[model samples]
Target: MSQDGAEFSFKKIAIPAFGPSILFGLGEGAILPVIALSARGLGASVAIAALVVTLIGIGSLLSNIPASILTDKYGERWSIVGAAGLSMVAMILCAVAPNLWVYGLGVLLIGAASAVFNLARQKYLTEAVPIQYRARALSTLGGVMRIGVFIGPFIGALAINFFQLAGAYWVGVVAVVIAGLVALSMPDLVHEGGAQSATGAPTVRSILVDRRRIFLTIGIGVLLVGAVRASRQAVLPLWAEGLGLDASTTSLIYGLSGAVDMLVFYPAGKVMDRRGRAWVAVPSMLLMGISLLLMPLTTGALGLLLVALLIGFGNGIGSGVVMTLGADYSPARGRAQFLGIWRFLADLGSFSGPALLSGLTAVISLAFGVAATGLIGLAAGAVLWYWIPRSPKTPS
Candidate 1:
């Protein structure tokens, strides 16, 4: 079919394309806020409870390459279904856990399943959407996930009133089952032609070796971006507490920031498609970095809220940019494998960002640590500005 025809066809698959993502986000959001609390209830110490929360990132980090292999072998639809099934089992385990260890294990498995689910949908969309509309498509996907996450806490709060803390896990269980059902219903699209190995499927080692340059350059930028973004979460609450804000006030500020974050995605995506990736990417990092730098100076709730909104707007505008860049650079034959590596770098940054902040805070002060994170954000902006292609290179 013609390019325009194919682009129009995306509309037909829109529901199947984005539905599972929303549900997955809902499931994750429902449980994320309560994981540490649940761990504490299960007899975990403060340190152990925090460690339990990190298990999800650890699980995802370890599973990225494996998840890619699964996506490549079984295809996107089955991988998504499998991920959803795994998530359901994980949530059930969390709900019925007899000990803190069991609950932590469940959280880890949930992370691993999330890696698979995310990679599959991204790979599917990368192949199915036409190049011209790829940015908007991916951005919409990101936005919908945010929408689900934003709404999920309310549902979890209601459930908690009836079922207590475990109610969140129950909500997760229901969400993933519906997500899996939606994945099962999605129509599988045929992949376009690309070079295949004559020897057989290429090894992950070979794919990485061939794409090492991309990984080192743009991949580094991705890492920095992930670090800065993840650091935002840590900076907010810590700084709020340092300023003597109560939990309810902090939560209100966070919710408002998120509301701003959800608003700019589509416009940002449109600009990326029409202008270029750097157009949104560079400014996003800069805004977030500036906000972080300003955060250290805030002495009251109003000042903090304004900075948070700026950071949120910055982050929201950059939604789907990382995924879009991955799609653009990924080779047709080993796309999933490449994205697996790409995601690993991003997730690595995410895992380390907060750890870095904590270490810095331990050594210096909260303000110093936050300012250092802001520096990382500025560095990311510079890297992306220099490295992001002026025009996207759509891989054949």
Candidate 2:
């Protein structure tokens, strides 16, 4: 088939492939807002509750390489199905937890499952989509996830009214089951005997040796991007509490921001495909950094809303950029292994973000810690500006 024909086929199949991601993201989103609150309700401190949220990142970081191996050997379809089932179990565990420790364990398992699931999808897309259409395809996937997140909190709020915090996990459980069924129903895109890499299968040692420089430089920027994004999620709720906003208000603001993010996904993808990845990357970090810097200055709910708008816009514009960049660097062969390492670094940043914010909060003020993330974002923006072009235009 021609390049255009292949791109068209990939695009057509992409939406179908996104079914599980949307549902999984929705389920996860349903539980995210209340994870900290539930831990606190179970007798944990504020910092400790936040730490529990980081457990997802930690689990993802630890599991990425192994998950990659699974995807590489088993193919993408089964890995996704397994992840969906495991995540459902994790949600059930979270729902039944009597204490913060058990709850953290459940969240950790969900994170591990999510890492495996996400890596499989990323690997599939990198191979499935053509270069010209890659960013758009990924951005659409990212957008769908945002849609799930945007819809989730409201569903969670309704669940909370009926069953409280535990109810949200029930919603997650149902969502995961639906997602798993969707995965089960989809045709096996991998091992359908599509394009196979000429370079042979990817191994960890070979990938590490080959991709070392990209990981050290541009990859670090991707990590920081992940860090900033993760920190925003962690910091915002705490910041809202510090401002004395109620739970409803916090959820409303976040949901609205997510809506804003969803609206921009397609546009962002177009910009990346047409202009360059840096076009979106630098501006995204700069906007997010500015929003974080302004966070400490927000004295009222209205002020916080404005900051959220900026954050939402910033985050929206960068949709799929990290995945796109990772795809750009990933070798055609052993793509899963390379993506495993790539996501590992990104998840490391995700884990570090909350921990770093918590540590800084303990040392200084919450405001200062939030401000520090802004500084990190700004630094990341600079790195992206310098490094993105210098990085490989296509996989080596």
Candidate 3:
């Protein structure tokens, strides 16, 4: 089979690039638990601790458009490599920060760099993967990312235990640098030369007008999914603590669930391609609602772990399946913009999930709030499934 009519092996280019990006994604995922713990150790308030999540979101939101512009100007590979290089710098800044504010600034930079690298690579999705199997390729991308995130935090927990936050930052920096080197080894995307052919490229003016509408539609979807998943992961430890679970227990739960996601991620992507993106999303949505709402009912560790695994499984669909579908639906001219907007909206949910959980914890209880997110996710998924229906990423 061929992608973009170029006879190629999926295992080769996609795997190499996809693998490094996974580390990048993992670093992004691991930051929260370690950093929040760092803040608490330094005597920061819970509100201040929440700032790290906000900074990351602000960084992602602020960077999206600029990152797109950079990708269009410099090409995807160089832009992604540059992003990785910047992330390395961010990790250094984070490692030595004396306070949460400085740490927030460093994380902000990390978010910006991540936004660029993520967009450049995702834009490459439509152009690089065969239309017939784009969902699968997108899923593969998600699977690798899940693996990195799965490893990063568990390793990070070790660093934090032995050496403190500095250790986690050091590891993150090294991993990011390696990711950059890996990205550097990849070829430039095919669109690097004359991607906007004169015949059909959207005029710059028209692009500005229409891209927002598409962004509007997809942004809502991203917000729904990003927030639901982020909140669950971000505050799950807090919930565990409330339930009397120990730190090691929390890590074990997170790790075990991550394993489930890792296992489900690739197969889920393959299913999306074979069965269609909608198939991956619809039932997953139903399950997400059922699983999360049941959080209040779990009687013990086994029940909590099962809920965690269910969340991962649903995410295996939404994060992996639906996100790939978004890559397909986005127009090529402003594909980066679509992604930027989509991710930026998603970041809103990502930021809010933790913050909201913290706030709600004050009023009601963490478990109740957590369950609410599942309801929101179900609502969002239903709207998207009904509205989008069955179709290609672009026109069929």
Q: What would the TM-scores of all predictions be?
A: 0.97, 0.89, 0.88
Q: How would the candidate models be sorted by lDDT, starting from the highest?
A: 1, 2, 3
Residue 313 shift from truth in candidate 1, angstroms: 0.2
lDDT of 2: 0.85
Per-residue CA lDDT of candidate 1, range 1-396, in tens?
114534366667787889999999999999998999999999999999999999999999999999999998899999999999999999999999999888989999999999999999998888777788888889989999999888888899899999999899899999999999999888887765434655467667878999999899989999999999988998999999999999999999999999999999999998998888999989999999999999999999999999999999999999999999988888877888999999999999999899999999999999999999999999999999999978756555
Q: By the TM-score metric, which is better: model 1 or model 3?
A: 1
lDDT of 1 at 130: 77
Model 1 regions lying over 4 Å from their true place: 1-9, 193-199
lDDT of 2 at 96: 91
Candidate 2 regions off by >4 Å? Answer: 1-11, 37-48, 98-102, 190-201, 244-248, 390-392
Write candidate 2's Cα lDDT for 33-79 as tens digits.
88888889989999799688778778889999999999988887789
Clashing pairs in 1: none
Better of 1 and 3 by lDDT: 1
